[model samples]
Target: MSSGFDPLHPRELDLPMAVPLRADGALVDVTSGEAALTMDDGKIFAAPSDPAQLDDWRAQLVSWREGARARHGVPRRYDDPASAWAARCFTVAQVWLWDELFFDFDAQRFTPERFLADARERFGGLDGIVLWHAYPVIGIDDRNQWDFYDVPGLKQAAAALREMGVAVFVDYNPWDTGTRRAGDDATELAATVRRLGADGIFLDTLKKADPEMVAALDAARPGIGLEGESKLATERIADHTLSWAQWFADSEVPGVLRAHWFERRHMQHHIRRWHRDHSEELRSAWLNGVGMMVWEVVFGVWVGWNDRDSATLRRMLPVQRGLHAWLVEGEWTPLAVHEASVFGSTFTHDGSTLLLLANTSDADVTYRPEGVGWQPLHAGDTADLITVPARGIAAAMQVTGTEPAELDAVRTALAAETPARDASFPHRRTRRLAPQIPSRAQLAPADIRAGATVRTVIVPSGEHVLTVRHRARETGMYDGAPYVDEWKPLPPRLHDQRTLERVVRLANPVRVGVAEVSAAEYALFLDAIGEQAASRDPERPASGVTLARAREYAAWVGGRLPSEDEWQLAAVQPGFRRRVPEVWNWTESEHSDGRTRFVMLKGGSAHESTGSDWYVDGGVRGPEFALKFLLPGLGQDASPSIGFRVCWEETT
Candidate 1:
């Protein structure tokens, strides 16, 4: 980073996501900066709050749309009949493939039904989900990004999700060039998509796919939607039907999402993964007649939705799912009615008008628009005025020519499902698994060390504060989001070396192994226990073992895996040593925030993948350096670049 680069306080990221159209026929040029970060929306956009300025603003907006379409040749959303799913995909979610809610660890199966059931109950249901498989955990070994998706039964999981009417999207890590190669990326990705029967591909890191990738995916699945992570270029919007509206800060008077406004059928799923308050994003999506990305578990961190946002999503989904045509094809008007803190947008089509209202204020707002025969879609009885919940949204429809059956179903569902008023942030803390101190742990250090399998170092009992070093990736180690409300975390704020202090408490002395358990020793243990151990080197530390396997081995020996604290404490001891080929050692500090599971790893491996910042903790690291590894499902936790050290809580 240069002398003045401050990633957290990037001025450009704080700007509005909507382009401003001044009344004086002047438009800001939005295509100045890098194509990935810059879109149709100029960074410093200001939406008009005064009602009188809206018409001219809208006229300029329309003119810009016309000019942009002319400048950039049309692609797919306009005429392609096959790419119609984008319009109806109002609500999508991004979930880790190994999310506890999605995968059954004990059953050893993908619980698609359970996942879908929870979604239906909480946020009505999901139209699609991005099964985020790799990156963050990638570069752990020689296994490339594709290997994560190549897990056994993964195809069956995708098939099951599709069977349940939920579209499955496989994530593509474009920056995964340094890891193990499986043919070329395009070919490997398309083949994986075809084999898994995936409907879409989530492009990680990139805003849009290159022509070659796009062609490859199109050949594999003709209508496969390529949804990018952040902003999508204007030219690419024709083909990439979906865009992720991540970290897009809207104006006080909600501004239209640039992509959605440019092409009505283009789906922009509004999401701020780290933000605790989703009311703003939900409201913005509602008024724009666009989409919302429900990301409860963001990169193995629990940033789950509150009751209020979930209820709001539930209220909009029923109507949006049914009358998506109105949102995409109808006449859309933003800021149609301005009632102080309450703002609304009206969508009209076929003698019917739908009004989506959002109250940005803290208090409940009542608005009486000059209208008749309005059927409330927000579960409200209004002879005159309708109440839009505080910091929430509401919708109502007036059908003139033959009331639609879809509207009736929507109304019925909306009436039954009451919206919640509570907008409090739902916080879930990651709890560390309790360590079972065996009888021998309390004995003198000499007694515990006498029969140890390897050289051991004692971590004395007491309160000790130690500094832990980690890279500030999106998976903020054991806490809230690292980037709250900040847009597009840059290199300085992301993947930067940061440290935090951990105050550890121990009741008794524990002996941590000086060296990681060797393969020969592990094979011997397996033989004694009548367990089959295969493909062992005999000399190297036991690698490619799961946390469960490591724990089981420790238990059999009347000991346990060392907690990260103990490992760090014993690392500087005189007898502590590392094997010839170093590998990350799994610790007992496994934690769960209910939605996601992660464990700590001490030391670092030499198997560092080059070419991308998305890889796991790499290079030979010091004792204090720890990696927060999110546990993967489908027996994928057994990584080759990882080994273990036992902390003896030896039994009598």
Candidate 2:
């Protein structure tokens, strides 16, 4: 029904027809390589020598007009194919034909029938079949590349495909050492395609000279196909030249088709390099006029030789499916571009919008969709912040008027539909962090060191309480030397050798309100802490304690740390941000040097004169006295400013 025409018939008897009108009300044959209609009634028409194509132009116009009228609910305008056939034909807008034809010039061996048979058998079921010409003559000189033209077998293949109810398209390139010269006359090349009974030509490596060449080619054969190579932009073709070539070819000739405008490259690299910058422009070309074709799902020369494995295939499926739905099935509309710190692409369709977030980083990225409710199609969970793995992609479809309840339902549906993938790290233990306190047995020994700030370690087996400790150095008057200064002596020397008793205890339990907090609240909490610290009196050891007390505070806070799962949950809090400082927390961890002991600092240090504040500001300070703890279940890395917050649970 969408195409408004059947394709099974060898030729149409009652072809729907229309007389295209210019803004000035003059009749224009759209199929002819001639007139173009401008918005302001201005007409730019090219006069071609062969005007006989005018009839074909008129017939196509009538068909388009009837199709449009039917779409608008008009009835009985003309006899049309049944709805089923029309819909089937339209659904298959394009097809790809494998180049299996063999040409032997020495023996003059040519078989059109065999080629036709193979075309129908291989690609007959598709809507339209695109035939790739002879094998790429890799080492052949440009002058002799077109020598295939003189070969009898090549011509037979083209004719056979056309006769077998298949449209034939040939590949032409501007590369050097090929059939055509780099600066060959465009008009002459156009004549060859027109005379060869070819339906269209796929332009390869079209440069700045290509548009004019295509225009000249159109003049020779009004409806001859005029496609461009993907590298035209690389060669610095003017924007106007590229757009004008497409516009002229599309408006003037019915057979003008553009294929492979977006070159095929690795899906991963493509997203990393070009998707953000070029997706919009490529999308515009598809909507503008010319039919767009994506070349390959995966990159490899031979069929099935370098086929994508299931893993890569699965990753790319959402993108390919999403794009197809937007460009072909769904109503076409304009979409604004969104730039994410991670990976994502967005487009609108039929009043609903689609946001695709792909995690290409080594660590997982927490995504929160803005201005809309989103449900993860892959996770089957509903939440404001969803974690996507590195190199993983998630698609979220948001429709207008979707209420919160409806959104939740959609999320549930998608989750149920998606099959979970197996993700295992052989080197480390992993656990999903949630609201409940994780059992001590689930915590793992993670190495913590300078520069190795964040890590995801597997929880080791067995019940164990982790004690973290920070390595301290003598400073100020002590100057890292043993007891020399009378003003400020080192803790070990200041106290009577045998009289001092060292004691440690957990601080008050922190109130847990929610699993995740908002960014604003997180920032505000940090700001509040800073203000409180600013108001503290620095004159007298600040109310709380002595040198021995300060050491105990640092030691107790610095000894134990939260697991990776715990850190993840805290980082993703819905609306609370807290500056983790005060007690230096220690993780059951190690240093990069393979040492068993390491420390993580939180809040600013008590020794201001020792340059602890300077070190923290300069990012040289480790989790010392003041630190915030994050949930490891959320995924850990060194990208964010992370310290630690300690917790003590009674051991049975």
Candidate 3:
């Protein structure tokens, strides 16, 4: 359509949208590994390999970061400088207990002592605890109601924990779900902090909580710390907030690390050490230099933490404590670990540098730190290598005030006693490659008449190379494409990375359902298969169905589960675009790790950004807001919200 369009180019794309182009006319394929910028003339621009080249690239990134900060009006310094420094010095964990566990109907069984004791044993030591929803009745004026700490000996127990150097923080839900007003909440916050001797308050779901409220509380308490629930709080209001590795399921190494690179340095960020593998949690913390909130179980959301999980914490606590000054308020720099699937970062405080490494692979990885001549760290426990076992950690302090040999000895003994484990896999899921699409031979578009409930659309296929525009990063480009010269044993799993434009070749033209499969249709399939359910409402999108059942329903309708690529092609291929429901649609794709099969769920319509085809897995019930969820099983696992639609492959 433009003068740059070369129809005869080898990788020419004839899709509808404009492909993102580099300054030199190269196309940007953010998801490709070899080269993000591919010229129409066949040249490739990859990452710089040499030191001089690398430095030039990093310089460019610094300039870009500074420009962004200026454009966004992000202040160079925190308003409360003392509080900001304090946030870096300490880490935080959370404890959520409902009436069942915290109190129960019977007051006699309230054992605050046992709860605190178990927390100490599991967590080893805690700098702060975010006691969520531990209030009386989720509001302020109802302080007369049986509060979480209202039981007999609870006040003394809280005092005992505070004495052990564990700063206690209580929840202050500003919205209070319409239970209390802002003025009332402010009064209760100050009163609770004094009554419980709390060091601060965790403002949960803090959209409505005005920054003035925080300032007021701080003025009243003089030195109270406040934590917001979201990472967005870093933009303005909160002193601290939880910032997890917000990755799509099936993310690769260094997953979501780049997103927080600059922001983590300026804010008191922390992540809940839940769902993801223990080693990953530690690595994420190390790379981003954020605090970890040790939350193993809250309500029925179990992270399946064990003794090894506890050991993992014990191994890092002292090292983190020893290097608190540097690890918290230091400049965080990422390092490339050679010869292993390793993710690590260096924290420079004063003159000392602490290099923290998390080996995510199965075997032992030998890390030779670049620039410095420190002895190579072995895969296991050793004098130089503070081995963290497999899928564990190893920290080496260089030129620090602390003795390296003593620190290594203590870490080695801990690693030796700790049980070795393979890296734990998260239940979340997504796609790596853009789904394969229809070939040019399959290009056939026609207006088709359909029944009332079964609307359909036809797509014409042609040559398309999936492309996405990406932002520049210190590592070159923050694109979904893997690193230059990166190889993988298995194909990638997710592709919902941010994009300016993405183009994929589509060759197989198929007819897809105008909408997601409906409850009426699912009911018919169930009845046809002699299966019965409790309720069957025909108009609503079918939900609470399994992959196998979805497949059966598709088959009944003379279609099949659409491949990941086909689903996308059908959804956005020009004239084929049709409105779909705000639900997660199950694709035919299945993910396996040699032992378990995880079904793929795509397109988070309600919770995620609209029009983006984000992916979440069907196993382990997704977050509370997830309307579609799956469990760990071989397609038999069924839950509410997860459903599927039908698509038929046609040879025209």
Candidate 4:
């Protein structure tokens, strides 16, 4: 590992954080607080203790921005109205492209409207959505990243999201070198962006796209904002309109986000993907006058948001939407309120002011703004003190002289409504959807009855507790989140090999095929059904078959794909054997949590992508090993390294 730069666990010194303002009005570029892996894990922002001295600190911040502009020659591209949407996007969801909420697996179609509705109810609504495709599934096949985006209805989905006032972003994986060779990444990416008419590019595993890439993507289409994965470079912030805070630990006083502070229009989204408690990230976003990356499903494991955070988001979204000008372009006051674990910021534009409050403590804190005409926009309806719940957020608005009808509508709607008190995490656990197969055991295959018996091994009917081993990849085996409230998962724990115990029961004896179905066998089955399929070799094991298609072949053979347990049971039997050039065997252990769907594969494949722990684990392995492969949509699940075996039930 060159430089020992662990993406899962980044060093504080290597991270860029909120620039703390020294007491003497000098900006100190500290790497802690608002930059640490979690809240309070590093030094706090070195600002004046007294709120009265904030004016000087604010002045110094402005001066530093001016100096940095001259030092780096900041073009301030945010001035262009073409990418104005980036500035106004307060909430952007990093949704798995095949997330059940976004795509209906049953219907085999994109459901953008359904996805948006969930966002509206649970987390107010989305301003932008990054369709996270490929990664965790990419290295499975030779098809590169662009092929995932080039899905049949991806453009339509992007158009639908755009028409609904939600900006759409496509994820660009720069580490996709092992896949099929394609045109230059820049050219291919630009073409994909142009074809999809995307509004932004989410730079996967990149702090900033290289200058050449930036230029190519810029020329792809107008208003194409680029969002880096982690804390973006200081100088690049001018051109890259957006980036998010990952594992950022804020000060007791909630330090300013450097990017947003340096340029008011430069949007910074706060995200801690693996953590279940989002209060810290939300607080950072709230104080920074920035956005939040709503990632319910991290890769494939579900680390969904809690009720309190979602409610907090719901409370502030209306105000943020109605007073977008004040929130993004208005004068920003960091630490506007810093009393007893409660911190906030004030944004004023024209005659309207919006106060965004966050409570870090575990109890409600009631306090009214220290001025008249402060009306609650997300808390108590009246002009009285509003309550900011424990580890929650609240908001209030003030009209300087006159109240605009639009602002009045927001106030009226959120007036008097109390914040949701439930801080319980809403978890989604994946469960195996065991399909019932029509037993055709009365007679063997026609060829077998005709003296061409296929080799088989039997798994007796009974409960068998099996020990299954798999790497602790993000695509967790079976169910439960891989990381819960974890700020950072390092080596030995991040991708370490782990074991699971599964007790499987079979109602009747199952006869599993000794070898994977050959390309010739699959071809015959298809031709018998009046269909055509591509096969590389007639004698080789059938590969590049989707889970659905595999199920169809198993059914056509009067059988079903073996579950991981059954496969394991049959593997150790004397008669069972693997086909030459082994591939992952499809199992009936298909699972879903209504948001993500995954399948369990047995008998590891020979194909493995080197250079990244993010790639699916590979190499030939025993039956004890299980691969929890996430099912991608639009024929992307078909991989040359994946195939299936047929199994049938034994009867009297």
Candidate 5:
């Protein structure tokens, strides 16, 4: 007895089946003639013709039930509704299915029975299953089904799967299948979904479609798991939108089955080509959006050497487990997107900021976070610093008030001792000069307060060495003399119009190392050097060496490198600064390049003339060239300009 409702109009009354019974209790007349079959609930059974056949049919039903019980380790009695709504995440192979049409039922490779069965057996306790229906060839000629009204088999299959606690979702196509006569109504498909009793639908092929369709679907089911597939503008999706398909078929929504398990070729294609190609455009479109963008990898099928063992689905358990919270429950915001060398992204959630720093450069690229206060945390090292090498991806989460009290203590100590320095330099400045030669001044350490905080040692009273270099002259005996001799003719040593060049070296180099420098400082440094350098002959290069050398000097003076976050925070100061380019500072991060691990150096090098190129903007190197430092509060201070500063970690 097929136990499901017969197909009828919504206004029509239901009818009973007219199946004949056989003497042997079997369904004898099933294949002999056309019979009015009935579908009561959702179960299908044979309608017997002879009395004997009817009896045999009953026996068969009992045997089938027993077999099902033995196979699934369930009681003979079935639960009412047979299905439960449990949340779960799953991946689908829509592309593979579309590519390999009409899966070979007998071959076992194409059938989803085994996969679904295994999922239920393994993770049946979850809340719901997310199915990714990524069929790109829906409207194609050979598979077009615009006029075919009934797909009762599909509905039955869905129901059967649901009985075992699984939900069914079909990938919805906004555009008509390519062959469906140009303008097929999309609403008809929505009607199909309703008819099929589908739990939800994933929206795909939303290139230039009308927003009304999305609105319509939203109106149909406000929280019905609406996910967008492939290059769909997330901003355009409604606030209740479930997920964004990032990468090729990747889903931003967590708790759904991921797609593309064995499709490495496709994975590389998106990572290397599509994402690489349209990153800029996509980023520009998402500028006004919120947190880090989530993208999908591959969903359906498992990995194998060749395509022979498709049955064996490989699991990336570690990544899947680690990302569970973010994918399933975390809120995200898209920060910034970069093209070419680095696949950089920033996401923040619940006061925690996550920076996805991927090095796409042939050579390792180091990224320093600028504009936010952060401390580096390592897996084992006590240093509040982190380092990531080339060909690597670093998942850096900003340390907030949630950090341990021990960490807070260290930060507080550093904050108490470090002086508040303003790294900002305005575009224009009044030049101060001396009328008379200024004598060399060296302040004693005794005159300076050891624990006093100062913006710059030179700005306030401090022990510093004032170096007065000799000036260059084009003629005469006194022309090339030191400024001291040139100002011999003037009475007062200080004058409003005179420009005096002075380099102050701290009597005792203060420990001043930040994860990174501020953008304002970076900009100021660039401008200061530019103006000073430009004042000389065009053919002449500045004599003070490069920014790279300055960094090296800072390192030599006892300060360590700064991470991108530390640098960005320093640049912004009272507030956060956006973009600036100075010397790329080295970070203590180390990462793997398939075979080896190294560190990343943030900011651009002196060799990089422009700050715009993604390649030169951030660079990385191996540990061989990386500089090391004691953990914060270890009493190690090393750079003249590479001083260390402390930041207050916000409580969550």
Candidate 6:
């Protein structure tokens, strides 16, 4: 009478399976649950990894599949090769469109033909693409609305893409489970996949997918690729899953690489999302052996795809093409090389090994395998030491066993280099000059004596455009030595020493503070707001405050944080003192290194050279960018030597 099947003690199968049955009607032998059994679908069915569990989870799965056939009359299992889908998804890209933002009904914009052409041209060579929230036309405005079931031309577009040898995958939401068979969400989804001729579907926000649904979907179209949103395939429902190796900035890679070592080879991992930084683009692909999915704003998105970033990615196509098998299916071994700051991994395929090293610290790092005669391979160059610049990478292939001559060369090169130092200050310790004149730190709202010398610089309003040249070199590598060949601006950062002209339209003149907000001045604002203030040294710049808190202080002083343009304009004005106490200053604009939100910090600090650290986008609000340590009991372990400078719109 009970419908639920117990995983511990699977009941005997009284009836035969509906279809695709084995010749012997081979059922799951519950007695041999401890033994590993290969399923008809080429998936290994075994007991859970934990030793305490008495029942085999895989046997329970076999019993559950049979029960579904008796209850729902549909067979989801098949003898298809599991790696078929992953092999097809070698180079995947993502596509989507917004409502009316980049489209015009009259002009007939964002047509399927146009989108496909642009994607082909932009992505260069893509095997598959995952369509996200892509409706035929921008009919609805709500982003949360799925609107997939009734979208016009959804099937036609999918079929067209499939015709071009590109696999088409549509988004599916499994949480919309319903009770009735007619209204069953899985049934509808299965029908949609068939109707649209879609090759696969991406299940969003699901830790595990329902087996019945996965079965029904397979029954509709055999061997269809099922992709999960999460990096881990907790439930064996998907062929491959989206691996966010670079999500939260550089936080996810190590754990992801470790997980890849244990997971099934057929179950592939693909890096779907990343920050604007292109430095990690190739590094992630080579290190993790995962594919990259680039989302170009073909039509609808807040930010369109940068052509410059695309060109940078295109350069790596040759490497990806050559190492397809090794990069896609090779076994990953996380390496512990000499440098503690440098992270290393090796991908081995058929006795051939490729080493990947990434430098997280802000300094050049040297690494050599213990006993492998691996020459640093970069378009065929001989190097004694494999040096990776700050926030850079180095890769090489194992050519032969370690030779004493090769090892000696590496050792000699490393010995000749200067001893590694902390990345913060490269050359020498900086000294701070005491402020001779009184600053905002020493004054309060009531202490405003007329003619107190509150120096302010005025920036005239107008249409201003300027071209600036910036190199893609690391912070401490301003001289551009060994990395000169590797130095090139990717994305999110400017192209290597490339000149870019930007236009800024200012409607009115604005007055900006001559110096950064002092610790004493920030204390008055904190007290007025009934919050405890940190150190109250009038001469020191405010140190213990977040970007949001800095904005509050700026507001309390009858001004606001300046935009990147505003900050730059104000600092360039005549009579604008670059430094008083010398601290990093926060701006209103925001930039992200993928994990943390950072406001630009500018102005020379006590620990840096006199003219250094002065600019619009100065310091990130992260411990990695801190120039000095803050006083104890500040609630945070380390705070960047940073403060805020306020700016007001001039009405005169």
List TM-score per model, in order. 0.91, 0.30, 0.49, 0.90, 0.29, 0.43
Question: What residue runs in model 3 are displaced by over 4 Å at the alpha carbon?
Answer: 1-61, 64-91, 97-117, 134-154, 177-183, 237-251, 255-276, 336-340, 370-388, 400-419, 422-652
* 324: Cα error in model 4, Å: 2.0
**Candidate 1 has which clashing residue pairs, if any?**
none
Sequence-dependent TM-score of model 3: 0.49
Residue-wise lDDT of candidate 6 within 369-418, one digit each (tens)? 65655655443234456766555555666754443233233333323222
Model 6 error, position 449 (Å) = 66
Per-residue lDDT of candidate 2, residues 118-233 (tens digit): 43332222222334432221121122324334443446666765665545555554542323343464644565576566655555445234457656765664444333432233
Q: Which ranges of candidate 6 are over 4 A from the true structure?
A: 1-79, 87-91, 97-124, 134-153, 175-182, 231-259, 264-274, 278-285, 296-300, 303-318, 328-331, 336-341, 361-377, 383-394, 400-652
lDDT of 5 by residue, 505-573 (tens): 323323223233332333333453343322232222222232333343233322333333333324434
On residues 1-652, what C-alpha lDDT tens digit does candidate 4 reach at each position?
4465555544564343343456465545433334222312222243455677677666656665666566666655887889788988989999888999999887789999999999988888899999888878877756788888878888999999999999989998888887788799999999988898889999988889998998998898766799988777677887899987777666556677766776778888888778777787777777777789898888888888877788888776777767778777788877778676787888887877888888889888887788788877764445778788888777877877887667777866566445676777777777878674433334436764332356788899988999989888877767787876665677776899898888888899999899998998888766766678687465689998888888877877677888888999999999787777889998998899988988888898888777667777778899899888888877878888998888888887
TM-score-better candidate, 1 vs 5 = 1
Candidate that scores best on lDDT: 1
Candidate ordering by TM-score (highest first)? 1, 4, 3, 6, 2, 5
lDDT of 2: 0.31
lDDT of candidate 1 over 355-447, digit per residue (tens) = 889999988889886768687776664736788888888888877878866787887778777768776778788888664332322222343
In candidate 2, how many Å is residue 390 off?
4.2
CA-only RMSD, every prediction: 4.2, 29.0, 18.1, 4.3, 31.7, 21.4
Q: Which of the numbered candidates is closest to the native, going by highest TM-score?
A: 1
Candidate 5, which ten residues in sequence have the lowest lDDT sum?
260-269
Model 4 bad stretches (over 4 Å): 1-56, 412-417, 436-452, 533-538
